[model samples]
Target: MRFPFARVVSLVVAVALLLSAVSGFFALFTARWRVASLPGTQQVANHTFTEQIIVGEYRTCVTLRRETPATNDSDVVQVRREENCYNTFPVNLFWSSRLRDVSTGEKAYFIGVCWINRDRVARVLGIPEDVPMQSLWKRQCFGVRSASVGTQAVAAAMAVIGGAVLIFDRNDKERPYRGMILIAGLTAALSLVPLVIWFGVVKKPGFDVGPSLRLAGFTWGIHLASFLALTLLHFCHSRSEMARYSGPPIDREVVTTQTADRLTPTQARAGQAAEGFARLESQA
Candidate 1:
């Protein structure tokens, strides 16, 4: 039995694209885009909390860890970790300082650790100045975050559509592959936009805090993979199309060439008589 090799290959490519596209959306939900470990400790009452900040497209979180001193008898220490997360944007996009807590008269301070140096994070967050905080949450930063979210969402959506189209249009007969390739191109572009925006934003001078803030998160890697897959798929389709259109001519009957090269003398004479009869019949 012969296997349907082309169909199987198409299905595999579509499945891969679908999975990567779905995973790309995790960038919006995952809080691992940019990471930094601050140098100093925060003293809240009796506990001194060491800080690490994690920024995502939509939300940013800080993990504060405190360790109890080991006793003389035993070297074991007790450690407690606390995490606080806040929306990247406030109730209003313009608001920069304190984030409103659920309970009355309680507030959580929001700071952009992306710009703060490791040693300066403590001082920056400690001070209650409105002006510098406003500078940190610049309108441009908010715009970039918003744009990244939008492009990533659209890229994932386009990838889903492309996969569905590939699955449904099984036979290249309806010629929807062109549309599929176009969708792939769109998906690639959309996926690329977020990567460019975030990479550039993170590499900007201010975000380069001491100890080097790393963009070593899963979301960025996923986005990069999705972009590469979509791009490679697009070019593959284009090359296949070019080959299909520019391929050798289809088989056709040529009595003159065939009779001369492939027929016996008796067969050649019969072919000539048949051609003459066919012409006569058409004239009649």
Candidate 2:
């Protein structure tokens, strides 16, 4: 009853954290789908160009069609297309890229294609020999893949830690849980890394940077909102707790009594004489 405001603020923070956690989980999976479904391969006047797309957290690849002269005697041209995504191995999650071709309306599956260290993980997974390895490590390692994973992981951790703190620590003394604040801050910070990489490092010639950057910004905004809301909630609860803990107001009567008790014997006698003189003068 003393800190009713603290209790209310803590309850609100807890509810917000719970909702954030639930929504963050869904957003993680949705982000994977959205990134994977980005239009990678496009046809323009007999030339098909594909941009290196980051599908999910751990996979990155590019697909392009190559044209070559069929025979030396004749002037006939042959079209060769290498349209398959790669898994990059050692960090493979549950999801894989199964992109469909826009022009031919055919589906291309690149489930177990390993680029780096193929002999190590490929043999263990028992992937068929037909799956080719398109190991373009120089271009694929643009740091966005790892940054995306880091951001998502931090966001999930923030949600969990914030929710726990809000539920257990209902009365904030001066600040929220230091650990929760640290985690939320880290989540907000990590969310910006991918956006920076997208605009600065990954936006190269022939790459579709618009849609990818937009998606990254959207996810980053969610993390930032969570961080700000949790911070405000903590501040409100802390102020309420401080008010509750502060000492009660002093009583005027108690102050007068204490002052009289502390007076010297000479001062007490002089006060009595002054009172008697005042009474005598009133009578005269």
Candidate 3:
């Protein structure tokens, strides 16, 4: 049987999407325990720190995840410890940021907490009243700083590339589904901005660049696979539709039958020879 390449490709796409989503969550929350506030999630005002105006407003905005690791002990301990390591490695925040300081209106970079989602935002743009922004600024959060042109360059590049991928997929016969894939990917990629803004990685900005390369990579990977699948699917569909109306053959079918009435002496001799050979082999 032929290998299940289509199913295999689909599985690869599914796995990649799951991974992209998982990493997205990790970037959002820094860690399972660290405080975070996602778009729809409920926020529990963790804590607030006020130091100097320079630090801006910093607070431990906490949110929840569906599942978390209490400890490294589980039924699949070996698998968790060894294979498919998700939360073990360090998560970096510089890749995707939307940080800004209302006071100076800068990219707001905090020294010690620089890129690890630990950067102290000067004054977070959209903080719910339930979460403290003013008091946090008074308290010394990590000293926030501004986003450099290089960082901005990368963000702009990601968005442009993401857009280009979408366009190419449109004209491309090989990947008709590029638009849907890009939509999913860009949306997921954008999920990192709040952290960016909160972390002061991006300046009060134009285009408000999307997630960093790290997160973008996952979405892009899945997007490519999905785009290819969509293209193949459409191509197959077209071929099938064409086959339906292809019409019948212009020529009619003919059949021939064998009869004992016709036989030549040479043919009979050849037949006798074949029989003789078979009889000789059997006897031998």
Candidate 4:
């Protein structure tokens, strides 16, 4: 049993898209898990609670001091003092600010960290017994989630289009169907858009880093491979079409010489007479 070249190309494209989709799903899963594991609150001092500090590229420690109201009408307040616990050689991304609690009307400060090797830093710093160190901040995880979701969506589209092309398009002669080639080229070009955004816009130093970076990289690689396969298939189909239309091969020099010899009526008659004489000689 034989399959058309167009069908084979479409099948390959479908497989490639499927792999890219799988990678994207894995990346999405990892991002969600990391975000869920972060601590919601931290104990700043005795009998007090505040939002947990987010740790990113830089390590930090916060100390909270509670203050009593001076007058009966005054409200209680908490003071926060932050110190750089340890600075890593390679700086990562971090965001820190105070947020007001909607329910209790208390202010809490949180720190978010991204792309830092936290375990190694913890071991090296020998964190103090009192200072709480948790790797809770990851600003880039959200970007990873966005990129992964976009990748999955694009891959799914590619798979559907490729499968349709494989099923509906058939080659009539030497070349794959022109419609199939056109659709494949369009799909390959469209697929590249998400990858460009992922690498150029979404995958940033502070926003998408760490383990998510590895997953994003793998997803991008699959996408690139799929595009290249589609391009090669299109090139092959074009070559086949050209060959089909160009006509049968002949010795150009021999044909040209024979035609040139027949340009004059005298040469043509002399050649005919030579052929008749050679036939008579053979018969004798």
Candidate 5:
């Protein structure tokens, strides 16, 4: 069955926004993950956590610099032999602090990592060593989208409202338009959030030639698609209204009552007869 064009548009937009924003976020995360995995990220310690790590399912220490010019993989291996607790794992989104144990000459590693699967994480690594990894996990997980729940809430409101405005009209007598508006607006606003997150909010760092550029190009497409959906909605609504009313074509005329001149002769005689009958009955 054919649904309202507005609803269709809103749904599509919402989907695109969700996919892209989520895609971009993951892209950003993936990019960060890529940065983490890059062979050269670690630098000489600055006394505490100065390196970036991932946040989510599995938190791992990342070298802070997106691509460090000075550091090499050989150097990392050499440094590992010297430090006992500083076992190198996969790199991620959060930054790690460096601390040296004076008594044991063991450099303690503290890098926050968010794993790929945020909802269901594997057995958390680094718990065995009594290193403060859990606290680190909490901090990194929240940053996956934004710092506060309020941001998502605001984005949700935007999607809800905008979708509503674009979808439903007040004059729709056939069905309740208000609820449609609520759903459409809600979805639209929510859909655009991911785009806002990736393209607008968090600008990922620039890196050298590879799949990263390709990903950036794809994200740009996502942004375009989102804006286009909104624009199409406006056009569709205007066209629909134009088709619906057709410039106030013909006004229906209201029919009113015309007064009768007088009663028919047959009606008058009948009335006289009825009066006589009533008088006779009363006398009897």
Candidate 6:
């Protein structure tokens, strides 16, 4: 029997998409985005301290290390470290954000925790309540948080749907569906748009500058892999369709009958030779 290479490839693509989608979905819950060590000097009775901040889509961790002189004459210092990890509320803030339709000037309010008015994040981070925050930060949060969470969710869902479609379409290669490539392409687009939006909003040169901030983290990489896998799956379907349609069609049943007919004469000649040998043996 012939090896089912095409079926194997199709199944492999499906599995790749499923794995990528699962990773992408879980990446949303992790916090490994921007990692930095911020050093500061404070005149607290002749002591200095430094801080490290690690930020991510869903979480943030801060570590403060205080260094004090061990001895007045010694060059060594004693170190004290404190670390705490907390969940970021970007998506939560976005949920509380008011919605407005620009075209119709219609406005609707969401009933949830008022993150801005409550301002618990600043307090949690030890920022003074009297300090004013830039209005631009809210806008940035709206754009970055909304796109990161919303688009990733859509992309992951689309990828899962695409994987299921590929699995179901594997057996119908002889009469391939015309919509397979279209669905696969749409799935790729679903993954691609989120990546583009994320890059544009959060990863901009002007917005994301400085040594403390980074372009992306593991979540974005997972999304990229999901997009690439879906794109390759789309191309696979397209190539299969092109190969199936490009050549002249042949009837397998008719070809098999013709091959058997061509072999009949040879089979008859062999039978006659065997009969002659048997007659010679009988006569002897």
TM-score of each: 0.57, 0.47, 0.28, 0.39, 0.34, 0.54
- Scored by lDDT, the top model is 1
User: For model 2, which pairs clash?
Assistant: none
- Candidate 3 per-residue lDDT over residues 1-284, each given as its tens digit: 54344334434454554555555444333322222223433322222222111111222222222223345566432211110112111224433333443323355333223323322332343234444433433222233213221232343344444444444333323333545455544544444343444445323221122333344345445545544555576567578668878665544332111332366778778887998999999999
Q: Write the per-residue lDDT of candidate 4 for residues 188-252, one digit (tens) a residue.
A: 55445544654554332222343544554665565566556666777877787687796656798
Q: Which lDDT value does model 5 have at 59?
A: 21
- Residue 106 in model 6: lDDT: 51
TM-score of 4: 0.39
**How high is the lDDT of residue 222 in model 1?**
42
Tens digit per residue, CA lDDT, model 2, 46-87:
344443334333444444554564677878777665644445
TM-score of predicted model 6?
A: 0.54
Q: How do these models rank on TM-score, best leading? A: 1, 6, 2, 4, 5, 3
Candidate 3: lDDT of 246?
67
Task: Give me the overall lDDT of model 1.
Answer: 0.55
lDDT of 3: 0.38
What's the lDDT for residue 86 in model 2? 47
Candidate 6 lDDT at 232 equals 66
Among all windows of 10 consecutive residues in model 3, the one with the lowest summed lDDT is: 79-88
Query: Residue 251 CA error for candidate 3 (Å)?
Result: 20
Residue 120 shift from truth in candidate 3, angstroms: 12
Local lDDT at 166 for model 5: 42
Question: Taking the tens digit of each residue's C-alpha lDDT, what string does model 5 give over 1-284?
Answer: 87665556666665555554444444443333222222333332332222333322222333322222345544442222221222222344354435443223355445433444321121222112222334434443556344322343454455445434444443452232444444444544444444444343333333222343345345447546655555655666667778888453343332111111265778778877998999999999
